[model samples]
Target: MPNTHRLSPVPSTLAVALALALISPLASADDASGTTPKDLDAVVVTASPLKGNTESVATPVDVLYGEDLDKAKAGTLGETVAKLPGVQTTYFGTGVGRPIIRGQEGPRVQVLSGGIGSMDASTVSADHAVSIEPFLADQIEVLKGPATLLFGSGAIGGAVNVVDGRLAESIPDQPLSGRAEVRGNTVNDERTGMFRLDGVNGNWVLHVDGLVRDTDDYDIPGVAILHDHEEGEEHEEAPQPNGTLPNSSVRTKAGAIGATYLGDRGYFGLAGSTYRSNYGIPAGAHVHGEEDHDHDHNGENDHEEHEEGPVRIDMVQNRLDLKAGVYNPASFLESINLRAAWNDYEHVELEGDEIGTRFTNEGYDARLEAVQKTWNGWRGAFGLQFGSTDFSAVGAEAFVPSTVTDTLGLFVLQQKDFGPWKLELGGRYDQVKLKPDDRASTDFSATNLSAAAIWRLSDGFDLRFGLDRSERAPTNEELFAGGTHVATQSIEIGDAALDTEKGVRAEIGAHWHTDRVDLKLAVYQTKFKDFIYLTDTGVEEEGYPVRLWTQDDATFTGAEAEAKIQLADTAAGAWDLRVYGDYVRAKLDGSGLRTVAFDVPHGDHTHGYEVDIAQGGYLPRIAPMRVGADLGWSLGGWRASLGAVRYSKQGDLAQNEEPSAGYTLVDAHVAYRWDRPASSWEVFLDGSNLTDEEARPHTSLLRDYAPLPGRGVAFGIRAYF
Candidate 1:
């Protein structure tokens, strides 16, 4: 590992490390074996049809399972993995958070459930929450770069695949096995409970799982809204909510049931699941005037008897899925896998006790994959995927018009090995069509090609390289939106003449491992011909600023590194140290025509009138540089770890973006386990924000109003049989 020590007056890597360590406790220790939880690198990368582990695949991947997964689990999927290198999460109060990969978010990053789309409206807006529950996942895989060749063109940023194992592929070894857990948190008076049961009956396998989580408004180190420190300017006194964030509570319930038929040559399975949540939007984050409350009631137009109050979203989703596989059905074929899912989702925003707006969606996704037998040292897979969605909104906040979208895709993957080296190549094509209400129907086509190579330098080291050319078609909201959105308090305008985004990326990685040490590093760069983004126009309509969806040439460059060393082993036990750091630089390219420039924000102002210029410009909400380290020790049934990370102050501002301050977070945890012949029990204590620092994420749209939870501790117990 490189040295990061520095003086107090200087900006140093250690500063970054210290800040990261302070944010939250990462999941890295394991009790399964004497070895650390880093062993997940050897697990299969299910997102890929190649069925290769992270160490064998050319693509950069991260996997967390077993004991590591138990410790990392959080209320939202994004929060569960925010500590990973090169990954961050977007926060919108206590309930909403979506994963951001290399500064790419929204539709650019895909969230998948068992190799398929999560089939939710999360990508439609920042205020929406992801439907997939992290507490139920069996394993979570993160593809850290362009995954267009394996997933879809929209995955130019990357993909997060949660493998819940709802539909089993094989029978269990024991007659019955399962796990249960219950936990409580101090910051929010949280109570959460979850359980899973898997059983075998003759030639059939059964599975059932469920979870419930509830929390009150959480505590904060200071006032909920920090106007004084904003832009580093002093502000006059104003009424501000203190200590606890108002209207920031959350409640959720989710469950699933599945069964599989075991056969000699093939297997088939089905699953059904439901997710429901009611969460509040922070006080200052959402503001609607009395005029906006008049709704269509009892065949009347704009009823006006409603009273003003806080805003909350009630969401629910019902889904069904099918999976089937055939092994050696053909003489020259290896296997065939088929999967499909259908979802019905709806959400309503409430004003006081009255309904203000409602959104609904119906969607289905299906895929068929076939693996071919190896011929002359070459092997590959072919796949066909199709999906459709009908989405609509009603009432005051219906900014985007209702629309129907359909997609069809075809892809192929091939690879061959020669001695100590492996070469892989892939290609994909997709066709997308959109039909908007009272608008012309539009169609788009996208193609992607990729190549990768892995060379085993020695028994303990490996090097890999990858290159790809990808394209992404615009979504309906990006092409036709034309009204105000209450959640974001912005007037959005879309462009119908927008073109497909094209990008070329190159990445290189290296890994070295030994019994007592492991180290990995990767560097990547991508150039986009037409990068689409929402820019503040500096124009206002009824107190809300107008944001336009536009595109321009852009560039993204980043690097990530992680290391682990077994520092010592004595009569007391073994001690280990882990450290990681990452950063990404995103900016509009100077090669393109000059883009708009604004006078920019100061003291709560968004921007001034827009202007034009020809120069480099920073992208907004990109996570600042981070570096962190953790030390762990174990003796008998007791295990413990403590760590902190430093997040640098993000001064790279978009024309209208706000500047965020720097801060560090500290966290620690301790767990004890006891084993029996047929059962095991474990109890843990998790602590976060030990310093109670006032920190706001740069990636949050409500950073000026909502802060992270204050210092708190959580206690939990788990049982497995």
Candidate 2:
């Protein structure tokens, strides 16, 4: 069993904008009956400068919060949102999982916190965890498709924005309010607790929040490793771990405090927070092999066996933010908003008691936006954003060189309404510069444009279409990485001569909503001018495989749909049902030429010769088709939900890539609430993987070594005051 002792390691973190209030964009929560809107029509998309709701915006978006968010909350952001259509997770372990949006991962998908880049190194590698904690977020917003016109060219795939309530925009209606929760899991013997408090006095609002989590090695439905299809190829003396995965423990703690001063027409806020985590990487899967020979007393060479110690990561981050905004300005501008943040991040990779490598990143991101008044049905917002980062790594695994990056971007978004037709247009320009300590400085420019239109056919029916062209400057890692990558156990080489990547995407969608029924459907395709990717070179360096980052033309196509139906209120309670499905296909437009050459010993050492061949165009790690259903019900002080999702077997073939079998996951949740004059109390229980199926996602680098948790139950109690 994992230690249940509670410890506070630091004081840090965010003010939040809690979002749980509906089913989909289609319906709104009924306060009197305590029912939620399960559809997508009414939730506001706060990330947009225009401040438009889901239904009012031309982009496809979804917001999760309220009781729905409560039930969906998990240890990692990717797992928390994986059930959503067109979304998947790249799992390194229980401690590391990054969201993969619409067949895109790594730098292509941007993860934001409170409208700003997280400033963490999650994008640098798969083993690095995202800095944002889902337990502290009041609401989460997911945007699908190219979001470059508003955010940046890096967000060509899409973006996930977490609203941490670290700063208060206005004085709360109530004098004081807060919530607290404590939950535990069985599969990993996990324990977690969190709390958030908000208080208002005069024109000032104050906020504070914190969380702690600890878990041991997680149990698996079966053996951790699958047997090899081709037998007798390897030594069978080593035994495989069964029932539980080793070196998979985790411990985390985080905290933050913030306050905002309110004026008659403006507000200013300052906040600070910190986060720390120590997580173990699963053993056996990622191996570092070295041969050692000892000279015997008689001068004979004796070979000895070597074993590697368990690996773990210790990470810490501290951040400070400033926000100032004024509404109803005297000029043509209706509002002015300014946001800025500075952070220092560092993480150390430990091999047993010794430090193997350490990474450090210090950076700041700042932005300013001006909103224009509505004139002749025209509304818009102009934005200016600036950012800089200094990153470096020390020790044996410093695959990427030290570099400093700076960026400046200017963007504009405009919307016009005419009768039942709404048209939206946006454009952005950015200049990015990167200077490496050992390489010459390089600069690149990016241009992005998007156009969309919505036709309101009826009171609750609409059609939406969008088209975009986005360009991206290469990142430092993609251009200069060289040496060993510990996470994937490979020698990664980067090409500095790579050019800017360009993508053109087009999508069409339809939405229908009635008094009790809501539906949404959409499809999209993207063509890349120079799609950059990493591929194995069929070469070896220091006992590790070699992978090279290169570029090629490619195509990606995908579709997604979701529906929610509100049944009539019954004697038991009000019920709602939601069903969703999504699929994506990604392939290189054509094959690429590859070469293999290595020296071999034929009695005497024989010189190697180069052999060139064509490689397959298949893309690796694309998510499989998925379908799921969720049922929700609520009465006065009680709420309940049950859900299941099916992942189809992925047979898509990429050169040297293994196929992943699919599995079904079943989960259920139930909670009861009772209110008092000064506080409210609730107790809840959640069951996951009740069927105990051994499930592994193709997107996981450790898929063969780590399956998801087996049958497990989590129960908790929460208090709101």
Candidate 3:
């Protein structure tokens, strides 16, 4: 169990805005012709698997678009997603990170690509990085709360989907389109280059993309935790550290190709990608703090040098997706569509081929939907989905004798739009069977239901209420995971008879938007009947933390708010400011059940803030709060833009008793674009963390042992043809 600490009132993080106003500089750019409206663009979010307003959906969703990525300065998908309201990052170091959703990690949250399941082994462990690259993505989506209906059994916590590859819709009529960029950063002394190219000829479209990144040991802003060892205290310190990166330095490379044929009826595509990396790892806190202990026992030597090694990971994945729809031509029964996908994934770890392990997973999913035009103001979708997975592992860490699981589900959904009011109802049924290579098979089935409503009181005012019941079956890992988890220094144990987890989630929310201001607020609560978790016994039973996977009944509740304000907008440019935050309280049943595996005790809270400003403000990580401006001018046949992002410190973490400190990161970018003939190119310079301020981010889960690297600089060139 975690050492509990007395609680403190939630800090007043919003007060920082007052201080920012007193320190920021004024915008100098002005409208050249003064004819354009000053209103901000209407931001739309597709959070649900179906189409709906972000504010009115029955489920909670966070949307990150390409523009949002620029403001975040996040190098990877894991880092960018951590800035969401209920999301957090568990960092092994700067190089390795996994998103923790509503306090659930690993398999609980599913990762997808292009609307289909991604079979990567990311869910198998925390130290592994997801293969998707945010830099090459069109958008990143978060399906917060229970998403068991759209995804399969593993989606009780939530889901993340990275939308990349070529889209039949985004393709231009000019036959070819592509973008190329180069960038560099200081923290890890890292450099990256990427290019995306696509071409359309008749009914065929082809796309190819690639990215390469490499860095040396990152430069630490503070003392290094791994180097603080005492030679003569063998019993004091924990086991070996996990990753290879010393400080923040890490390496990554990826490439992908996709092709599609667009016919009169629909479109189908095939895509494949490969990712490789070698990064640093930090020892668990329990292990790091005991390095000074003195022990002389069992005729054993007390002094031994700590061994440091990098964790190596490689992944390859292939997917096929098809979307087909038939239009009614008439208003009634407007359209019927079907979506299907298949994926194959392989992940391996190596300390050299002789050591480590490998896991392979393959899955298939298919969904059919029918949409109807309402005669009396009602329209929605009804669907059915089927999915299954086969998993296996080899080498030292392999779990069971390879297992296979099959699942089938059916769902019905309907939406009614009544002027200012909207209502939706959905229900799902699932049947699953797990077959092990050498054990009796387990079979289970569950049903889930959800209902929600929204009221638009006015042009810019809205209110929403939602409730849902969800269920999730155990994965192969939770039923058979064995051996030691090197980073956590825990001898992991699994429970085969664990029952399915079922829960109720509810939320009430409102949103207000105007030409100059936008605000959103929501209050949510969740109750779980059987929650799977890990419990610590505080004993080194097998040379590590004697921890076992368990389950219990629990309750959780929280509230969240997000807002953005338009400070200025003119024909020349515009600037804006934004902020967001959330707080949650979770507790187990009245039994006072000391601890259950993987469970966080009650009264835990998390919150964050962002400030941003620009002709077009951007916040990638936490939807930054900015106080800056943009300037644009035309010189000859070229247009130039200059902008700056003054990012505030990342927010505090709920899981940590003593949270890390926030820092100020200042970045500047200048770009010049050329307009000549049918081709154009852009050249720009970007400097991040310009002030060299020390900041610890949630993405750096190993902050106590590894601080982020300081200042960074990068130059890049982009072109479109």
Candidate 4:
């Protein structure tokens, strides 16, 4: 394997390893097979279509497990994920946030649950929140970089997979298990109620989950953050009962169900989900023109120019999954497997009178995978997939013009162990078809390939290298849409002759772990040809921003680092600490036109850190670099935890640049449980932004419109039955 020692900071790497080696004498002399429960186990994530340990995968993967979720006191999938590296959100306020990966926003990113696309309008606009709740998730996986193959052509940038219990139905011999939870937040008067159930017995197992949330308009720390034009605003009509309101109430309901059958050889399952949302939509990002003060008569007739209620969207979708595996559980062929799923989504926006526009997408995906026993110390997998989608929209501003697309892909991956070293290589080929309704059809084909290798030189030292090439086609929205979206008020125009986007990325990393610390560093670069961008010409249509979606050739490259240390390990109580951060420089290669996404007149960089307490603590968004300490005690049948996060303001941005200011949000969490696990229940008292810190998320879409919600307190109960 290529030497990746260059990825790390020489001194820190050596110091951490030596410290751990020194402390090894105090640790129990356990076998190298990782037989102790106290040792950290490698997490299984869905970065590759198949399951792979995080440490073994060449690509960068960030995971948020159960304890991590509790620390954040997060309500939605987007809220919890915003804390990970290379992940941010375009917030419509504190209540509505959507994940943005490496500056790539909108439809280019896909959100999934149990490997199937999340059937919601999250991608339709920035103001719409994802229908899936984070509370029910066992873990949230963020896959960064060209992860489009197993997902779809849409994920040119990357994807988020929310792992819930719905897929656990495939497991046999497990009894029905379920949990219930309720929470309330002070910031927006937000209250949430949710429940989840799972079961597996003999030949049949089932899973179901649901959630509902209601809240009033959120409160900002100061005067509502308003554009210069709307600050001293004057209106012709009278206002409603809600304070400073324009239809900004929040309400949502979602439910999912799945069933699986296990036979002597393989298993097949079916899953379906329905999400309904009727929530408040905030005003546009920009409020133009000066405030006119004629009081009652000023601009009374300009009704078309002013939006009355928050933009409302309703989305409904259905999905089905089928799988079959053969060859019982052997040393290698855990069994050959095949899986398929079909999803249909409908999205619509509503104003006072007219249903602005409607979009419907029907998609189907299927894949077959096989695992072979070791051949010369090497094990491998070969897989094939076929997927197709049809989309259409109705109204004056139709973005998706009734198009059908199909893709066929095949791939092979092999892993081998050479003493303490391991190697993995994979390659895939894809053929894509695009047929527009009554338009010139386009048939395009491309090839994708990846290779990675890992070397374990010593007990605490590891080196890894990876390279991949990928391609992506434009979505129906990018190829046909032409209209003014109320949220950002950007006049969007699509191109019919746009070509496929292609690129290659290479990365190298060094990882070391010992008793005192665990540290990792990685560097990567990507070159793109025929890249796509939506360019803003500093123009507007009737006060609405205008931009054209076009293609360009460009390049982006950056580096990242993560580290964790055991500051103090003691018998009375252990004090363990962790820290993680990354810095990225993304820009256009030629003709600095700011055409590439997130690329602008100025270069951009994002960084943050978390100092986790041993017993437990809070993990807020932008969780300032903190110094926290906690204690955990267990006596025979009882256990408890208490901790705090001393958050500090990092920095702030100008009005037009980003919405955020320095502030501290203090928070604490306490929970208790019994030894009779199955019948025991725990209640948690959680406080967030405890300092009542009123701040804004720099990545929020509404940064210019309002501050982050004030302190929120939620009491929740978790019961397993």
Candidate 5:
């Protein structure tokens, strides 16, 4: 058993009080001045190659920046964006999480840093954390649907881009400008601080940013395990006491520095960053048996014994990025933009104080895009992208073999406007080579095509349709892994013969906008020729269940809808009501032809029953349907919101899978800002799981072992100059 001690909440209470004190005066000032808040439209950069706003994009996009981002930021990327429609988080304890978009995760959804691949091993495993930190980001963009034309084969499902101004593309208006923030949370006794500084001297722009965060084990509402009993059932072990979860602490530090030379025609910049983290993995899951030992004649142990302790991960990453852009050139291309990044990442998994496994990845990605002036009423951009990675894992838990992968891709995007309609077309071709140190090399080539149209039916309504055929090559982990994954408590086996996955996606959506109302509804379906997924094998290896990476013809269908209504605009505030919902259903068509065995009877008309090998099964770990609503009020420099999200019970299950009960989580936030002549300061309070609901995300394999954090309040303050 693990320790059950809890941290005092005195600091949390003080932080909350400080925030309220800062906000009360602001609210009073707003009332005396009788000022009203202004609503501003948001701009998104990941939707397309060209600049576009959320309302103008052909597909759904969510952008978080400024005060909104600070209020919503969490320890992990998944939790930061979990409230968005069609998005769910796969929580691996409190230390690691990645977003699950539209029922797709792993390699299908790409996590990017400034429009390029993050070059991290997050996709290789669920317990791996994304390299980017939300605190240091200037903006985070979530682009829904197929984005292969823009990002590459890895973005067959969607893409999330974290934009940090480390490599400054443009110089700031002021010579020196920066921002700083401090935050504290009660649930985990977490404390965080971050700052960014930018200075310009003689056309040379310099940037520096740093962040530090530390947290203890998080508190929970109830016992770690729940037991159900009937009138005639045997009783098991009693439930553990409600307290903090053991081995759930986290500590992280990151920093970056960069410089840019800004000329009249173009700008070029380079940046280098380093990140370090040490986090404890949640305990209470499966534990392997101790190694065998031979006793001596005197009853002494023959082998050394290692102390048992919580599992943890110590990770470090060093990265460098180069960015350049030219406003105009004398060649055929009107302008050009270049971006490249090189990353060195490594992490060690420690059991107690002993290292169990170490993972390393060294990779580089480069892309060059050229824009052309309007030619024959069409505007477009063409780009070439290349990337290579060498990855290895060594130790007792080395599940996958060392591998090297190289990829090159070329893509073009064009758009034309005719009357009240706009048409966009794009195509990409990628060639990938994967070589395992101990296995035969495999080569894959894929061609992806996309088309979209937006037609204006009236002044405030638009209809959009999109079609895409995207292809993705299998990853090394999916093709070569064969070992136990301790975090998930499962034995994983991979199939080397799996083919590339190809998907055809069709989407139709409608957007309506008015001074008082904004609405969007989209429906989409994707059909795959070879959909790769992990399936339970109903077998056990070393006391752990087995999961095999397999491929099958599958289909995924989903819908998303959101509406925002402006109810009132008064001196007290601008009140708005918003409602959003999303759902996805994925199923395998049928079981392919495979060999099977059955019992035989002698001299009987019916010898035995035929068994169907794993066919017509639902996809595992898909997020349950969700519906949510929120009310917002903003006046002057103060803002407040109250919301609730209701997740439907997930009864649909694959073979040997269990169902998860439905849950509703309530959340609220309040913020106030104070503006000065040359600077601004803001304080906010955020509350989550106010009802203390026992919620478990169905998208996570650790749902049975770890539940979501309960009844937490956070206080934060930010300053900009």
Candidate 6:
């Protein structure tokens, strides 16, 4: 029994009053000192094992910091970085989301913490949330294109690294330094607070950071259900509030502490962190019939009923990290860097206070690298990496079996400067083993090779090209799953005989930058010998549709472009215009292997259906084409921006999938800052969906039941001391 009461909308008068309060004139001073934006050639560490600037890297890289990061911050990593050139979110309600890069997601796109893998189970399913918090990050880096040579086969598509200064690499300039922020949003009465502090005493440095967040169910523009237009006798509609989605609330808290000792040559540090959260899963239950039904004279139920309820997840994680670096070391190595981390995570699914399922994961990752001095115009590093995880699920709704996975990899990278051109080459070898408690074990070996080049055509222009061959081993869920998944309303089946997935990718791009303009354009294509994907069988099991994990040949082609121009500059301020667009198309290569014909049960009745399993079709849940633009202005310590993004209709749908309509969203933000002798303070206001558009993200599996948030505003203040 769950609450079924309709929720009332937030009063318009309250929003107007808040807007007026935020717009009041306030005293502004000169721009903050030593806080200007970085140049285009900023150093990027994630692109290579060795340090390199953006201009020196052959692949495309996007970095967000300072005010830009604050403006893009959202509840999930996917939505926070969705505005980037070639990034999208697999939005599973407001509580869970993961980044989808270049139209590739799941195991293909790896998410990293600092320079190492996060070791979370977010990639295992759509409903699981990413474990990291964006509000505490100092900088986030997006490395586009293949990155398998450095991070292993999981990064065949790309990688996202969230850099938070938890483990101190260097001493702070001052003895004591810190920053704090507090914010609140009207969309769901959300409130968030965060703080970070660092202290230096003699040769020892210490760090501490923490954050807490809470929110109610978010608001929507219309009813939850997106009515189907088919001419039928009737379609049952659930009673929903006009402006709010049910069971969409969330609460989270996390903290970390670290200490480091600095010596003449290098530094060593250790850190420990803990994270806890409880969040409701929106529209996750599938009620085919009521708990009890009336019987007829023949001892059979005459009719069936449906019921809905609240579902939630309670999760916790504890992690420990160690880092060490030595400079000017003896022997063949000029420098050495070592990093290791261990994590213990667990989560339980609950249906109206009753436990439905529990998931647990314990893992550790370690990597060691040694950098060599320049030799014959070549400089690079060689490294060894090891990782292991034990994962298990119990209770009635466990869809995947318990398993242990282990991986070992060795890699080498080399770079040489040749006049106006730079060349880079890398290779890696990995061995992975998967062992299930109740099934046979499997092993896989993968070899990856990558080559890239950058040519400086002119003082303000450069050309880039890259090629890579990568392979990925199947995950445990794809090889041993055989159960009903209530979250997606489907009965899933896995094939243990599936083979490894191999892909070849080629890319070419150009970048131009100057004092007044910046532009980037890239085009890429990828072919897969064996690509693993989930397919619908056009049949029913129990009360749900049946889906199977399968493999086939596939291809993906896409392009992305972004440009910015200086509109005006005067004593008052500087104005700039920005435009960006991206598109990706995916298709299966071969024909069907067989045809499936069966009877699908609707309630208690059966209907016959047939589908060609061998017929080639488009991939499911692919993001549609998107185009957008923004205008920004900055004067002294004040800044303002406005932008709009339009998503095209998604008509190329897979078999048994529904199409999503296109919609546009508008947003705006304003901020003012004041600088003092020892600290700085800033206040800002951000508004989203200003037009109250009924926008639905095509990448979301629950788009028909959960639309995007309605019109709302957030105001906050930050302090640096």
Residue pairs in collision within model 4 = 71-619, 91-700, 91-701, 531-552
Give lDDT tens digits, candidate 2, residues 365-484: 998999999888899999899999999989867889999999999999999988999999999999999999998999999999999999998666789999999998888888998777
lDDT of 6 by residue, 278-311 (tens): 8887763333312221221232343322233477
Encode model 5's per-residue lDDT on 1-721: one tens digit a residue.
1111122123223433443353345434544565443343757574366767776666568888876687678888888887777888888878888988998998899988888788878888778888888889898899888778888898999988888888776779999999999999999999999999999998899999999999999887776544222246553433563677778899999999999988899889999999888888776553442211122123223223433577888999999999888977746667898889999999998888789889999999998999888889988899999999999999977778999999999999998888889888889999989999999999999899999889998666689999999999999998988776766667777878889899999998877665566666777889998899887766543345667787889988887777777778998889988878787888888865443333221223323323335866678888878878899999999999999999987765777778889999999999899999999999989999999988888887667667888899999898999
Cα lDDT of model 1 by residue, 311-371, tens digit: 8999999999998989887887888989899999999988888888888999998989998
> Listing every candidate in turn, what is its Cα RMSD in Å to the true structure after a full C-alpha superposition?
6.6, 8.7, 9.0, 9.1, 9.7, 9.0
Best by lDDT: 1
Q: What is the lDDT of candidate 3?
A: 0.60
Question: Which structure is stronger by lDDT: 1 or 5?
Answer: 1
- Write down the worst ten-residue block by lDDT for model 2: 8-17
lDDT of 4 by residue, 1-721 (tens): 2232244234334443553464454333322445332345678885464477777676667788865666553656666786565566666754466666655666667787766566555665566667666777878888877666556556667888887767553463438677777777665677888888777667877889898878787655554544434545654533322223344556777788888777777777777776666665555343322112223335545544544444565556666656567765676675687777787777676655557668777888777878777667877788787888777767644534677878787878777777877877766777778788967777666667777778887666688887778777776556655555545556666676788888888888777666555566666777777766654545434455455566666555555455555555455545554444443434445532232222111113321212211111111122222223334443333333444433233232211232235454455666665536455576777666666555665555565556566566667666757
Clashes of each: 15, 31, 23, 4, 0, 2
TM-score on alpha carbons, each prediction: 0.90, 0.90, 0.79, 0.80, 0.88, 0.90
- CA lDDT scores, all candidates in order: 0.83, 0.82, 0.60, 0.61, 0.80, 0.80
Residue by residue across 1-721, what tens digits does model 3's lDDT show?
2323123113212323432242222211222232332343433444344565555564667777643554443655667786566676666666566665665567778887766666666766656667666777767778777777677667877888777754444456678777777776555666888888888877878889888888777655544564444355334444443322243456777777777776675556666666666554433322311223323233223323322244455566666666666667346776676667777777676543333677788888777767676657666666677777788878755644478888888877777777788888878888888887868888878788888788888666678888889898877667776555554556666777889888898888776655555566667778888777655544453244545666677666656565555565666556555555554445555442243333211124311212111111111122112233333344443443344333333332221123345455555655667756877777766665666655555334355566555566666676767
TM-score, prediction 2: 0.90
- Which order, best to worst by lDDT? 1, 2, 5, 6, 4, 3
Stronger candidate by lDDT (4 vs 5): 5
